[model samples]
Target chain A: MIKYRQELSFKEALTVILYTLLFNTVIAIVLTYFLKPFWENFVFSQCIGILICLCMLMIFRFITTENPLLWLLTILSGLLVGSAGGFILGAFLTEKNPLVYIRQYHEFIRIMSLGLIFGTIITYFFLSRVRISQAEDRIQEEKIKRLTSEKKTVESHLKFLQAQIEPHFLFNTLSNILGLLDTDLTKAKLMLTDFTHYLRLSLAKTRESTTTLSQEIDMIKAYIEIFKARMGERLKYKFEIQDHIGELPFPPMIIQPLVENAIKHGIEPKVEGGEIIISAKKDQDFLRICITDTGLGFIEQNNNGIGLTNIRERLNSLYDDKANFEVMENVPCGTTVKIEVPIVTD
Target chain B: MSQIKAIIADDEKELRTYLKAQLADVWNDLIICGEAKNGPEALNLVDTYQPDIAFLDIRMPGFSGMEVAEKVADRCRIVFVTAHDQYAIKAFENEAVDYILKPVTRDRLKITVTRLKEQIEVSSVPPSDLPAIIERLMAELKANQKTDYLQWIRVSSRDGIRLIPTDEISYFKASDKYTLVVTGDGESLIKKPIKELYRELNPDVFWQIHRGTLVNVNFIDKVSRSLSGRLVLKLKSPPETLTVSRTYKHLFKQM
Candidate 1:
């Protein structure tokens, strides 16, 4: 069934006409099959069926999207119009006067009732099938959308796992530690202790989803220590945190990956290996953390790696629109990533 | 008392220290004369020290432990130390060569030490099954290291079945039924469709510039606007320019 709009398109109007003809033809065939012997004007009765179907269609077209009473009135008016159409055809076929036709008004009433019943039933059944098919198509589309999103989630999770284990960083740090063992024993010892702590924290169950801000900071500190050992004198970094912000809840591995990105993309590419400044500040209901590196800022085109993208995706999933992550240029030089997360107290 | 010399080679110092401490507790005569952090260094140590036994971590920087084991198999008896579990160690189960899992406890070290002592007492050379065990382990590691990235493409050309590196390809164009794999060497034809090939290539390198065109970003010389305001990609080689449709023009926006 076609729903009413401001105006029906050519295709929609054609569909309406086609359905009307089909339903009316079926009703006429059924009527003729039963009353063919008694009715002499069988062909005339078929023409009357087509005329009455046209009346029903016109009534529907004019009052489909109007008030409920108007629609009820339209149905009642359609029956009257259909009966009148049948009477005129009967009068015309039998070559009788209007007064003579009035005697057989009961026959006209029966034909009108049959037309109304069959027309409503066929229209309702056809509309129900169309609506059901439309509903099933919508359901299938929703299922496909859900499966595609699920696949993307699983793929991102796998990428997150891979990012957690930086084999290049690991091997380089191990080699740096070996190099340090020959010259500086104390520094090597310090690096090894931090490396083991970092490994332990990374493997801990807390890192699977959530961790306290202080725990994430501790992991970042350990990471910085390992990086400092590897880069040595070429890289420098500092951290500033507001008082009492340590115990706030934060996602694990989020801040650490950003800091890693800063070093890998920002500092390591530069010859001098610039300094990084990480700061955390509290503002009303939001906690803002900024990681700024003094390296080749926006000049590096290949800066969007899995780590930064994963951070953004995880943030979106966790906080929806409440959290924000932005990458902007630092004043003097380099890039600054500012993350603002809602402070949740427990 | 006879002194048994041994070499400990692991990328991590902590593991090496723990293994040495466990060995000292298990066998007093087994002295670790040298330590190497990587495979090449381990090979150098085996040559210089000529140790009776060598403990090699399977995953090491540079050459890796399996490669080192091959070079030192003639002179030293080998024990592979790996982070992989017993399932991965199934290749070593039936062979004469032994393997110990990581986070090695004192008991596991003692077992390996006792086996080494027994072997040394029996013969100077390695057991006959050592070569076969190493070969199997190498094959297993190689199989595990195979990644999902599209590394090479097999093309049936007039030159008779050439395997071309995907990295050498500058771009791909779909023509009729076959896709043309254009490389610096020459253009090759592959039966695989462009859509299927696109999924296998690294997204960072190969970008879909058009509906039927995929170009490697490294080969891109410049992106310029045409008189008709359409974006055209000027490639470095073959002197061919590809038109970017309005739908895919965002790919060149950052350039």
Candidate 2:
């Protein structure tokens, strides 16, 4: 029906008008047959011709998008063919009076033209509308498709980030373990053991679009071990969260850069690695995350570190402005960065 | 038992270096043969190192992980490192092998290495499936790998039948007996059915909306209803509209 609406033709429209006209003409004759013979005069015959003309006019509205050349041919054909039909029909009905046959013959020709001209004009009007409607539909469809594709890309990009970040994170941690390999083999071996478990959990969750907060935090804790191994006695960090938000859904790799930020801006800058606090709290309608670091704050000159910017963009894109991120000087001297976003609910 | 030699192939410089660095820590039994930046580099590394295992990245320049693995088909086992998609992952899984998703984890690497060791220990996975897996992976690359042009198309004008590149097409519409292939500059009258075109053209590029028409999926905007349950596509640029068929209702799901 949509295709038909978009591509209706004049030939098809004319054919429908012609058919309707003939159909109405025949029905008028049948009614004339049933009417009282005393009242049936030349006026009644003219009335039948007008009835056929009206039917053709109405049909023109239905098929407005017909081909001009094809429609012209169809309308001309309808006129010639219909006139002949009326002449034949007239010959049988008005055989006794030549005058009656001639008069009715002229009347039938006029009725056919009425059906043709009006049908063509009205059909062309409706057809232009069809074309307009189809164009509008196409525009709307393109917008939706673009949005969907963007969503997929955002989703895929999120996955890719996780994919890119996870191994990179793991490998870095492994390198930290490697640093301890010669110095402390037993501790390095234990790090490897815990790291492997963390990786299994991470890889297991890779296919999913979202995971629970508890699951994400556990993965984070596993990751922090490698950092702990790297920082040794210098680093300090803690995990804080409310119990109810454990099942809230967040995208994979939500905590990825925050931890890195804690390490980069918070722990790494200090001679004795400063304490890094990673907390996830539940707001009335959102999950509040604070990756506060007790070290040098973000270098104002170096505003676009890949980790902080990437996290901010992903959060903005995912949660729009619903996400809250704050980077401010800590109570004493270090930087405290806070991030809050809507928790995904089960 | 002779030690199993291994090499890491990845596009990321940091990843390959980091993997190589991390591999040094554990797996004392395995030899750290070499590393390559891209697929071709890795393929060359394979010739030089001839390692027992190749860790390949599915997406890479010159050759994919799957392609380089083909060169070392019989000699070594493959552990694909992919971002994770059903079309690509199936190739490795079907062959009873494994893939490590990026960012590589120490634990996952251990698991994969453990799987690799087991495969070598038993000689369980068939070497013959390598060719088939390679072919399947290549086909997947063809499927998921998007193109700007149509695959097999034939266009007609006063000159004769010329195959118009899919990208050159602006739009297509079914006229009485023929389908008109409209372009930015002109149109082509071709005697081709939309169904045949749908099968031959890349579905990733071209989409079927109406019985009479197959539109470039990229050209479509959104599928919306006019009156009742009718559906149509809002296109980009020259900005035309198209209608969808009842038969293909499930296609525009989000719309």
Candidate 3:
């Protein structure tokens, strides 16, 4: 919907009445001067003409906004009613009966045709003006809708970037590396390398819309490596994927958030910390990726968290109804998140 | 001076070891009695050892450091160790609670050690204000995190769709596919299941007393033992008694 004002307000009606009276009076004055008709008769006939048209408009409530054909029909009917009424009223004032003029068929046809031509011209002018305004209104609404959606996309992108480069994660990872430097030098170096990789991938991937499954998995591996180093034996992870599926095109930063969520909300909160399993498979025309964690059982509220909601929104915009994001309780304990997107074979 | 006993609690082993090493360097006289890997373990260590100081990581498994501190505040001094929690840090600063940020440096540890030593020497009793401060901080933290709970529930009434505030609800009972939202006035059926409603409602306000029932704590008048030796709850507004299941009987243990 393109909605227009369906009812004319009191102020608008009054304005229309005033404009009609002024226009009719001007015509009446011109006719009285040049056409040699009685001034009072001409003015009275003109007044009757406008009054009948207004009455017809009020009775029918016939201003159409959507259908042009219906609008034309309404104008034609209004002109027919107004001119007929005006001619009858004018004839009664001047002569005894209007049927006397109807007996002269050519004269009656000439007067009625003239009235019809003037009415059609006036109605067409107003209709075109209304149509132009309606078109302008529609364009304005569309521009606003596009601008707002564009702003939303930009805002969500910024939020996604902020979530990816979370200060808490960065600082905690750095703290772990610092602690590791003293006890295990080699492990510390490995963690630093992984941290660098994670950061580089996060920064680079966020700027782009898409990346290969292998590239995203590489980032996820780096991310999990940092967490593994931080949590030690408390954290375990496994990845199950075939070599060919890695080459598939996937949305960047999609899988990593789910992995991060599994670690943060599911695994990190559990005392035993538990394992996270990341797997991907092709189910006919769709590519399904699943992240399962063996930690605390699914909490109903975790699904509404910023990370998961963002993933859902991104998937919705990217694929509309073609992609799906699902969260379910893992068997025995923990939470499993699955994302499915249609595969383009080429 | 008597040897000051202290316990360190952090989920990560390396951080715990690193803090121990740093503590050994900064305050040699302080005795490290125990180390804990999680919140419950930390609380257990606190109870077991009755340590003078507790170095707790703000984020730990089972319970957060803040929750642990709330329980043992009167028993021990808490020094929260966190990575980067802006809200917790702000609360700590406002309350004058001691906290050490992560990548625990010897220099920061030294400052904390000096303050802790002064506090220890000044009073043998744990600070009376510590518990209150921790309680306030926990409340603030909870308020910040719990913005998504359902405030209003949409239900179809006799006339039309009505938005009933969740606060007015006395309880919810599952009935087939729909859940009944009972209030003082009457009950309305909603399409949402009891399981889904439980998730949306604030856990603090709505207690799941049975598999099919979730009762608002505000409306609960009393808990009494039925003749069958099962726990039952009496509501103030609806004037109804609800039976508590064996699985959820522990919820009324405190009462």
Best by TM-score: 3
DockQ-better candidate, 1 vs 3: 3
Report each candidate's C-alpha RMSD, comma-separated, in the order given: 14.6, 15.9, 13.8
Residue A126 error, candidate 1, Å = 6.5
Which tens-of-lDDT digit does each residue in A259-331 have in candidate 3?
9888987888888879999999988889999999888744533334555656766776677657876666676
- What's the TM for model 1? 0.48
lDDT of 2 by residue, B21-61 (tens): 55665576788788776667888887888787888876555
**Model 1 per-residue lDDT tens digits across residues B1-255:** 367899998765656776786787788878899998777789989999989899998766556678888777878889988765343477677554688876566688788888888888898677766766677777776676534567656666442344444656789999999999997546878888889989988888899988888998888876776535678787866667888878898887777
| Candidate 1: Cα lDDT at A112 | 59
Please state the CAPRI-style docking class of candidate 1.
Answer: incorrect
Off by over 4 Å in 1: A1-25, A30-215, A222-250, A253-313, A319-346, B1-4, B83-87, B94-96, B145-255
Clash number by candidate, in order: 0, 32, 0
Ranking the candidates on DockQ from highest down gives 3, 2, 1
Q: What pairs collide in candidate 1?
A: none
Could you give the DockQ of candidate 1? Answer: 0.02
Compose the digit string of candidate 3's lDDT tens values, residues B1-255.
688999999998888988998899999989999999999999999999999999999989988899999999999999999989999899889889999998888999999999999998999768998899899999898887747788666666543344455767899999998899998767889999988989989999999999999999999976877535678787877878898999999998888
Query: How do the residues A180-270 of candidate 2 rate in per-residue lDDT, one tens digit apiece?
Result: 5656679779888878877777777766867888888888888777667655666787888877777788877767556766675455545
lDDT of 1: 0.72
Worst-scoring 10-residue span by lDDT in model 1 chain A: A1-10
Whole-model lDDT per candidate: 0.72, 0.63, 0.80
